[model samples]
Target: MVKKIEVEGYNALIECLKENNTGTVFVHFSGSLDENGVNWCPDCVKADPVIARNVDKAPEDSIFIHCHVGPKAYWKDQNNDFRQDPKFYLRCVPTLLRIGSPQRLQEDQCCSDDLVQMMLEETEENVTPRY
Candidate 1:
């Protein structure tokens, strides 16, 4: 079974990553939620179901981290930690990335079931080597 973790903010995400860095790790960065449990980003809202459905494509021991990147104002700031952090350097919400690898899907890409499954099932041998 895949291990799933939900974290809010950059600090929480960093802490979670420190503890669970090994194995097949996937990080999903999305917008923060309100009291109603609804995310501020429409794209994130749309991509959630697609990602959830494709989770089974990953290995059983894989780790899935769902990171909420705070409110719209926070995410729009140029100094947002998620964007500045070299490990992520996120350009948009609803980003699905394979840790320790170059594989990633952003924005509308995350809403595509086909792309999400492809990323989840991709292996190290399938990754294109970086020059």
Candidate 2:
């Protein structure tokens, strides 16, 4: 079963993953660029803490996704039209999974379609859900 959902910024995304879980976890990071500190739509990050500690917290073989959309997302601080210091772009996912790698992220195709594709892939060879 898939558990947990989030609408977090790049920083929040990482902090969330640090939590514990034993089930398949599905996260939807914003793929569209907002005007502030938000980037839940940039990319999908997966790994098992044990094997990759980034995906699910299952016994061994598990799936998990860490996502981010773009830089300067969310309600911008000080209402500055989402304008931010270019240096900060590296602090978040520039486009998708290229967290701290704005240039690379911008060149990548990290969008809703990516999320759908990933979900579809997981569904295709998915194990028997414990639901």
Candidate 3:
């Protein structure tokens, strides 16, 4: 089973990243809801289940982070740290990336079970981070 760490806001996300410096780190950036329990991004909603289903495929001792980027108003801002950070270069919600790795799946790609599985199982020797 994958070790899942769900965090809200950028500060918490950064802290989680800091704590999991070693081992496989799978990060998912998604739109969050308020007290009403409504998601801001539809695609993110669609990808959630797919991600959950393939979580177990991650490398041993890996950490999975689900980072919620708040409501649509905050995420749509161009200056959002999650988007402005060159390291992440987050262009859209439901973006999955391997920490310090080129492995990334975004938008529609996140909806594919096979691709999600492949991303989780990727190793240093067999796969290289795309960015």
**For this target, which candidate reaches the highest TM-score against the unseen true structure?**
1
Q: What is the lDDT of residue 118 in candidate 2?
A: 45
Q: How many angstroms is residue 103 displaced in model 1 relative to the true structure, after the best TM-score fit?
A: 1.0
TM-score of each: 0.94, 0.30, 0.93
lDDT (C-alpha) at residue 87 in model 1: 78
Q: Which tens-of-lDDT digit does each residue in 13-123 have in candidate 2?
A: 556656634443444333443566332332323211111232333223333343443343353344322224342333333232211222222223333444334432343
Which ranking of candidates, highest TM-score first?
Answer: 1, 3, 2
Candidate 1 C-alpha error for residue 68, in Å? 0.5
Off by over 4 Å in 2: 31-131
> In model 1, which runs have C-alpha deviations exceeding 4 angstroms?
129-131
Off by over 4 Å in 3: 129-131
| Candidate 3 residue 21 C-alpha distance from true site, Å | 1.0
> Per-residue lDDT for 32 in model 3?
98
**Which residue pairs in candidate 1 have backbone atoms (N, alpha carbon, C) closer than 3 angstroms, thus clashing?**
none
lDDT of 2 at 83: 27
- Steric clash pairs (candidate 3): 102-129, 102-130, 103-129
Worst 10 residues of 3 by lDDT: 122-131
| Order of the predicted models by lDDT, top scorer first | 1, 3, 2
